[model samples]
Target chain A: MPPTSIKSRFGSRIRSLRDDRGFSQEELAERAGLHRNYVGGVERGERNIALENIVKLAKALSIPTRDLFTDFP
Target chain B: MPPTSIKSRFGSRIRSLRDDRGFSQEELAERAGLHRNYVGGVERGERNIALENIVKLAKALSIPTRDLFTDFP
Candidate 1:
């Protein structure tokens, strides 16, 4: 099995959680205090998320920061 | 209850993990491809960690990146 890339792993996990929470990308971005384009890049695995942003996402979701970084499957 | 600050949470988590592995700050920094000063700042809750660096640290520790972001009770 191929080792999962961090970008893909992070992207899929965030997208899944966002969808589960009924948040559109733009909505999530607003909550996380990030740009919509940046959020799109992250969901598409095109950008590297920063730790500060991760914290923001966690706070916005009312979850632990680890929730954003979880490995799916 | 006072909400734990993100800097403190992240700093403590990384320090605990590093200590558990018996790696010095310098050694961990080398493994994570970050500067010693940067790692020190992180451990001291004085730096904002980036996602790429988070990935690097996780890979160095042989743990999932989310492991670094966990909230310790």
Candidate 2:
């Protein structure tokens, strides 16, 4: 199998974190002030994900931006 | 004082890491397969910075992408 892309890994990371927080995609999107579809895209690894959006997600998740990348390969 | 933007903090982090690695902006850009001007813009906090480019820079720096956010506020 091809190695997982970092985007996929990052997306999985976000999904896992959202799960840990018991957040629905809509809730997370609301908290991040992003469109629900945009949040969905990021979680699905379909977005390139700019730093600003990353920061918004981190803020919404109540974690340091660095923590968003914890255990990353 | 106004709070520093995360973009600026991230940019400074990259610059500091580049300095620690003893790399000129051009050399680092070359390693990351990015344009020197683009790298310069990133370091200047003038770019929003996509995840793929972030990964490229992390690989070029021989660091985990998480390490790029070390000591982030």
Candidate 3:
């Protein structure tokens, strides 16, 4: 298994889920009212987003935040 | 509240619980068959230790792993 950071795991999970829904980073960011760069950083596991931002992302993406990371492989 | 990474929360909780038990970082690492530096790294939120290692730490500390991070403030 790849050595994964806590944020990276969450980010990877988010990317996987967003990809699963066929949503682009730009689209998801727009929906979440976050910057595209910020979304990309989040997806790449390069940022430590706030829990509030997480809630916003979850709400915009229509997925529970836990669901984004709980089942990561 | 300050933004936290997942592992930091876990590590802080571990430190708290270990302190609760009057155990030093070296003591806990020895109990868990982990290096003292590794334990320090985990405590400082600077490393992404494996799930297996987490399990070992939990077992050695005699606390459920979820208790380390769940209900974090």
TM-score of chain A of each: 0.85, 0.94, 0.86
Give the Cα error of residue A48 in candidate 2, in Å.
0.6
Q: Write the per-residue lDDT of candidate 1 for residues A1-73, one digit (tens) a residue.
A: 9986677778787888899899999999999889989988888878777677777777766787777766632
Worst 10 residues of 3 chain A by lDDT: A64-73
List per-prediction Cα lDDT, in the order shown. 0.80, 0.91, 0.74
Model 1 per-residue lDDT tens digits across residues B42-61: 88888777777888888877
TM-score for each model: 0.80, 0.96, 0.49
Q: Is 1 or 3 the stronger prediction by lDDT?
A: 1
Which candidate ranks first by DockQ, i.e. highest? 2
Range of the 10 consecutive residues with the lowest summed lDDT in candidate 2 chain A: A64-73
* Least accurate 10 contiguous residues by lDDT in model 3 chain B: B64-73
Clashing pairs in 3: none
lDDT ranking, best first:
2, 1, 3
DockQ category of candidate 2? medium
CAPRI class of candidate 3: incorrect
- True-vs-predicted CA distance for residue B36, candidate 1, Å: 1.4
